[model samples]
Each structure stands twice: as structure tokens, then as C-alpha cells.
Target: MIVKPRLPVINRAHPLAKGLVADYPFFERGGTTLRDISGNNNHGTLTSMDPAVKWILTSQGYGLDFDTTDYVTIPDSDILDFGTSPFFVETWIKTTVNNVRQVAVAKADVTGNFIFEMGTYRTLTANEIYCEFYVSGLYPKVLVVDSSFFDGKVHHLVAGHDGTAVRLFIDGVLRGSNVSAYGNIDTASWAIGTYGAYSPPFRGWNGQIAKTRVWKKAPIAREIATLYADPWALYRSRRGIIGKAVAAAGVTYPQLERSFQRGAFRGIKMGVAA
Candidate 1:
């Protein structure tokens, strides 16, 4: 028998929740609209449906599927306009397409002068999944994963600048990091499943994307690991050992106290290493 751990309770007013600007759960069964659960009204509009987009059962519940010609368009908003602030983009994806640059998520202007994309790129030897942030006149930071996730298996991909470095994580493990200046992203719109009109030849992603999240604040290594463990769980991003211990077990205040009195959680390491 497989045992599923109980999910933790999250405080909605916590800073972690507030820092999440765009959250696409893709929970709807059938519709052209994909609602943003971040409470910031950053809903995505579907366009150019070749076979009509719809939600299907994925490893992580219901997820929206996009054909090669379909994509989701999110209008420009202050919440998405990160002006040199630390930011991260994450999504759960599965695809078998190779030899093509496919975009999972992107923010770009109509002319594609400046663009930011978190997607898969084609290389001579293999395809690479990366998070790229670029400025019109500046060098862009592209953090790529060493291994590919194109085996038709659902995998987690995350790319972001954590204040000091641009990092990429696959399935909760840090794969690559680079130190560079990620210029501000001032695009007029954001697209999921395609790169709009970016200069790069990367086009729409022909796969299944379960969820996508954008955070204005940089997530540390521990937080990234925690996210890989429980993608939907909400906890304080920057917390001490004690706070992290409680979250690791998904215990409430009372449960934590009881566990302490019983010495059940003693000597238990916290964070991702645990």
C-alpha cells in the first residue's frame, strides 16, 4: 500500500503567499480561460486553438494541454513587471519532442526586442531545459540543466535568480548555476506554451504543463528543495530551523508541541537534507 502524507496548513497572509504574483493551477475541467489563483487577477487568455484546448489528467491532477499552435496569453501587469527584483519561474512539464526549441513560459514584447523564457532549447547533442532572462542591450543569463527530461515522464523544472546567482533545478536537485546580471524584464505580455515573437527560434511547447508559478522574491536552496517535495504547500520562504522543522512534518502548532513533549522529532534534521 502506498501512504500519502497529509499536506500542511498554510497561512495565506504569510509573505510567501504574498510574494507569489502569478499562480496557474489549471484546475478547470473544460474552458478557454485559465484562472490565476494568486489573487492578483493575472488570468491567462487562450488563443489560436487548433484542436481546442482542454484539461486532462496528469500526474498532478488536472492540467491544460496545448497543441503546437495553441498558447496562453497573459496581459502586462505591474505584478509581473519585475524591475530588477529577484524572481523565479517554475512549472511541471512532460514532452517527447526533440531537436526543437520549445517554450514553456515566456514574457516578451510584440517586437521581441527583450524577452525572458523558461523552456527547452535544442543543442547539438541533446535538448536543454533552461531559464533565460534577457535585456535588449545586455547579456542574458541562461541556466541550463545537465540532463534532459524528455522521456515522457512528468518532471519539475525551475529557473530563477536567487539574488546572487542564476540557478536551475530539476526534480528538486540543483543542476547548474551561473553568476551574471539578469537585467530587468519589462515585457508587455507573458505567454505560456510559446515564446510569442522572441528573436530565438524557440516556438510553442507541444506538451502538457500542469502548473506554473512566478515569484517576485528569490527562493533559497532549502526553499527550492521544499518546493520539489511539495509543490503546492505554502510556507514561509525564509525561516529558522525551528520553523522549518515544523513545516517539514506538516505539523500544526499543537501537533508540534506534542511531538516535542514526546521527543518524537528529536535529532531529526530539517530542510532538504532531511
Candidate 2:
């Protein structure tokens, strides 16, 4: 007889559920300081002369909104440096700007040591993700995602070096791959929403960044698939009260039944705490 392990009935309000904090340097909070939710204490400091960057309430939680000119700066640390190790950066972003390159996450200097950019390549599709992986002595290897990310809806974006090649995942799908790899990506500092202090500061992201996660080890395809399905699952399982309210507010009950039919977590039962 085969027995299946019981999965915890996850509470959507609780982000620190089991196996959720596996990624290091995760930023999901929206506040003056972008605290690292991964419990690594690798928080990022907001840097902007004006109030261009601010926090906003998102469906998942609080998210950071950035103007085309605002960005966040993280101090130089060994944790941010991945030396020839498999690493990945994943985040949720929503944007409509596709005309110019928008840097969602980057680590490099003005001379272009290394950069993992989205909405890259001037005139390139706003939905594409770009990466410029380079070590001190090795030649730079640039890769772009096969898919686009300018859907105007919230979408998951991920880029990483999986020990042998560069990989890109858009909405849980392996959209791009490049065999050319690099050794040790070293940088003094890293920036979010823009390229590292480049002259004139190019590729500043103009969108809402909800969740940002950096992992030292590359996640397998199954893990990535789970991450993608989380939002849909949470909406169904955790919104019991809200879903009922919505149904009551509507004129038709059949619509609600249809919704439940299409919803996720069908058989899993959860009860409110008394």
C-alpha cells in the first residue's frame, strides 16, 4: 500500500508557511526598507532623491512601486556574490513599458561587469528578459528569454545559471536557455529597478515589484511549477470568506458555482479558527 504525505493546509495570510522560505534574500515586504523575508538579513535600502518609489497594496500583499527614475540599492556583501555557483533570481512584476530596456534586477558597474536585466535591448520587446553573465577574466555570455513579459498582468519572472547553462523561466515555463556559462559573477553592489549606477542610469523599471527571491541553488522545474501555481491556489483555498461575500453580492448563484468549478484546491478542506 502506498501512503501519501499530508500537506499542510496553508494559510494565505501566513507567508512563512512550511517550505516557503527556501529562497534566500527574498523581498516581499513593502515598506521604507525592503526587508529580506528569507531571514538572511540581506535587506535592501531605498535610494531616490524624490518620492518616486513607494509601496502599494497588492493582491498577494504589499508591493513596491517604482517610477522610471527610482530604484533601490543594496550594500556590497559576499552573499550577493555568486562565485561560479548555480544561482537564480525570481520575482513578480507588472509593467507596460516595452519601448526601452527596464532593469528589474542587476549587479554591475558602469563598465558592464555583469547584469541580469528584463525588458532589455533597446527596441526589444518589453516582454523579454536579458542577462549578461561575465566573470573577471572569462568572456561575457549574454542570454535572452524566448518569451515576452509585457502582458500588463502580474507575471513571474526568473533567470539563473543552472550549473551548466543560463536559463530563463517566464510564468513557470522554460522560455529560454543558453549553453554558454560564466565563472564567478563578482560585483561591488547590486541594485533593484535599475542597472548598477550606470552613467545616466539606464534601464530603470517602471512597474510594481511584488515578490523578489534569490536562491543560491537553482530550483528544479517541479519547484518552479509549484511557485507559478501558488497564486491561483491561494486565491481559491484562502479566500473562502471573500469568495462567499463576492457570491452574495452578485445577482446570480450559478456564476459562483461556475467559479468554484474552475477554482483550485477542490477537495482540500479548511476551517476558520474559533
Candidate 3:
């Protein structure tokens, strides 16, 4: 006789009753509005929001541009209110140049309270991409991705914290985890694209970004998978030219490549003349 393996059962009155149970421990479709940030009808890059700022667009992707003054500012009213517990931040980004300074795109206070930062640093010969989180301190708990892992290509980055430990993700895969001493992000003037008083100030972005989102509660593995699978479903259903190029060429969008190549060539010619 053939028999199926039995699954574990849990009481309905359990504290985790709202989420998936042990028997069916996976989230159903369209549970959260995280996809709505990208919208449901549009594709391509998220050009600009309702309020206009002096952000320089280096490529066609969401969060591709960085404003000199402040890319995005969250007022006290809209600040994500947490109850001294866990939280998560997720976004997809395409890096333009290796070893360049660029924030991972996050919300933070002016003095630096709840912030997520991602950038690259050059060693003797190679470059490493690293992510750090600061709740209320000078130094942060950092997770670094080796140069070989980061190739100036598109990657999905996720940071999750629960007052004691911090975790990092790349392309939906768990990369590294670290322990920290801080918790809860209660700050003012949350900014993205740049940290507080960092060098290469207001330089702006140089690549594409998509499906940027934030959640008040720490997301489980299944939710993270769903976000990675269909990042732009809520914002727009159809893929744009950029998406097509990536699928066919195994590289970034053609237009972005052309822009960078042309710009670099022009710069080289100018330098030779001088």
C-alpha cells in the first residue's frame, strides 16, 4: 500500500495563527501589497514620483537616480512605526561601476538612526560589495560580498533585523548573518540614495533599480520568494524593453549599456586631448 507522509499540526489559537501553518507553511498568492510599490500597469523604470526633485537619471530603472539634496524624505507622519521588534527592507538594483560609492537605497534619519547602506570598496586589486545597518550607533553590523560575487550586475538585496540579529540576501539566497546590539528605528527625515555626510556627495546613481519595498514585520522565506519571483507584478504586469534585453543578452538593458559606453568613450577622448 502507498501512503503519503503526515504533516505536523498546530493549534489554531497559537500566537502565529495569522500566518501559514506547519501543514501548509507557504503563503498564498497576492497576500501583501509589497508589489504595489512598482504598480500594476506600468513597466520600465520608475522615472519620478509626484513631487519633483533635482535627481539625475543615469539609467532607466526604479531608484536609478539620486537627488543631490535628498532623494527621498519620509516625514514623521509617514515614518514606519515599529513596536521595538523586527523589520525588513528589500530592493533590486543594477550597479553601474565597480568600487563606486552608492547607497543601497533606504530610509534614514538625518543624524542616522534607521538606515541601510550598500556600497563597494576596493582592496589591493578587487572590489567588494557590503551592506550595513545602523539603528543608533556609529559603527554598524556589516555583511560583505566578495568581489567575485559582485560583478557590477543586477542583484536582489534584502536586509532583515530582529533587534538582535541581522541577515543579508542576494538574489533571494541567504548570504550572511550578523548579531547586533541595537533595535527599533525611531528617527526623523528618512533619506535614500545617500547616507548622512558621506563622501562623493550627491553624485547620483548610474544604473537601474526596480521593485523597491519595505515591510513593518520581518518577512519569512516564502514571502521573500514571492517578492523575488514577481517584483513588478503589482506595479505593472508586462515587461518592458529593458526586461527583454536582459532575457536575450544575459546582460543589462541595451540602452543603458549604450549610454555608459558612449559616455566613457567621450570621456577618454576628452582626456587624451587634454
Candidate 4:
């Protein structure tokens, strides 16, 4: 029997290089389309974007600015379904409005039909907000609370189900979690920058959002930490996947000096294979 060799992560940019389900760089100048660079066909349509002023550019590049009521929607498909399997979502957001709920990404419908919704929701305390990953009523998620996200600055946010617990990471730190358990997930259209489009209380996000990614896997803490430490790596990483893994996942690249060869492979770092 052949054994699969274990190797160090090639890029350490993010965990999504292997199981990227969707990617939105928010780079389209068309002002109406958010291209899915992941090649997963999960394209989104801008509800009310103006080519002239809807985008904001920084040293990192362009990002979509939402006005609470605006959001991007993706059509329903089989690949979007995550079921009870592990899954994760990551994105960069900047906003000061956290008094009420603000949805960053959601694929849910009321009346029992649901998948998941990740966003900032008002807590019992006045003006206090907490991040939530609502799976469904049957598997309601616990709040991942942290008050610093309302600072109106660029921050990395991540949430995921790691087969056991629902987790939330802010700026690469694991902030909170809850016991996670759910049956097969429903197939619903995806919405970004707001909650459900077919329902009320959209929980719109009034801010700039960019570099949203989804993966059908558990949360990888090291990957998140690396990305938070080197924010530019996120931008440096290629847009789409190269065949299976990320374009420069470092497997074949000798830059990292990581190596995984045939049989009883030594714990080697990637670099110019020699």
C-alpha cells in the first residue's frame, strides 16, 4: 500500500488554495459584475454600483463600497452547498457602523430553508455587536464577539465550521467559537455585503469590502496568522487556482525550498529542488 506524504503548506498565504469555492477580488471596473476569480462560476451582480465612484483604491488596490442596501448576489448551484462538511469564509472589511446587524456574506432563507450567514449582529448590550455564523434554527450558532471591528479600519475577518465548532477569527486571532452540528445544507443563492435578498432585515454592510473567499474546509489558524502578518501576500497570491491548488501554492516552486519526494520523504523545506 502506498502512503500519501505530508508536506508543509506551499504559500502560507491562505488555506483556500486547495478548496476554494468562490473568490471575489472586487476588481471589476465594469461596475456591475464581481468576477469569481476562483473559476468556480460563482459570479455576482452589483445591485447599485456606479463605475465612476463606487470603488475605492488604496495601495492594495480597488474595493467595492456598499451603502447598506447594496449587495452582490450569486445564482444557486450545487457547488455552493456545503452540507455538514467543514467550510470557511474570509474577507477584508472596513466600516464604522456596527450598531445594528451587518451581513458580510449569507446564503439563507427563512422558514427552515437555510445554509449559513456570517455577519455582525447587535448584542444584548446597547451598540455592542458580535459576529455570527447562523447555520439554521436547528443548529443556531453562538456569537463570536469582539468590539474592535467597529474601528473603521481595514481588518481581516474569518469564520468557519471545523467539523466540531464554529469559529471566528479577527485579524488572524481566534476570537470565539461555539459547538457546531448540522445536517445537509440547503442550496441557496449567495449574497455578499448584505444578508438574504429575498427576506427583510438584510443586515446590509455600509462599508468597503474586498478579497472575499470561501472554502469547503476547516479553519487553518497558521494560514490566517501568516496572512494577517503579511497582508501583501494576499494581494501577491494569484487570482485563480492553477489546476487544483493556488497558482503559486509553492508545490513546484523552489522559492520556498519545501520538498516532498517519493517514499519516506524527509521533512524538507521547499526551494530549488536539487
Highest lDDT: which candidate? 1
Model with the higher lDDT, candidate 1 or 4:
1
Which residue pairs does candidate 3 place in steric collision? 38-235, 39-234, 39-235, 39-236, 40-234, 40-235, 40-236
- lDDT score, residue 27, model 4? 51
Of candidates 2 and 1, the better by lDDT: 1
Worst 10 residues of 3 by lDDT: 21-30
- The alpha-carbon lDDT assigned to residue 8 of candidate 1 equals 29
Which one wins by TM-score: 1 or 3? Answer: 1
Write down the TM-score for model 3: 0.55
Give the count of colliding residue pairs in each prediction. Answer: 0, 1, 7, 8
Off by over 4 Å in 3: 1-63, 66-70, 112-115, 119-126, 135-138, 148-152, 196-205, 233-274
The lDDT values for all models are 0.70, 0.58, 0.44, 0.64
lDDT of 1 by residue, 188-228 (tens): 68888888555423487888988788989886777778777
Residues 60-129 of candidate 3 have per-residue lDDT tens digits of 2323333333243333322354446576777666654556555655445554354555544344444555
Give lDDT for model 2: 0.58
Q: Give, for candidate 2, the lowest lDDT window spanning 10 residues.
A: 1-10
- State the local distance difference test value for candidate 1: 0.70
Local error of candidate 3 at residue 261 (angstroms):
28
Error in Å for residue 55 of model 1: 1.4
Residue 21 lDDT in candidate 3: 11
Runs of candidate 4 exceeding 4 Å displacement: 1-16, 58-60, 110-113, 126-136, 231-274
User: Which regions in candidate 1 have their CA more than 4 angstroms from the true location?
Assistant: 1-15, 50-53, 136-138, 143-148, 197-202, 235-274
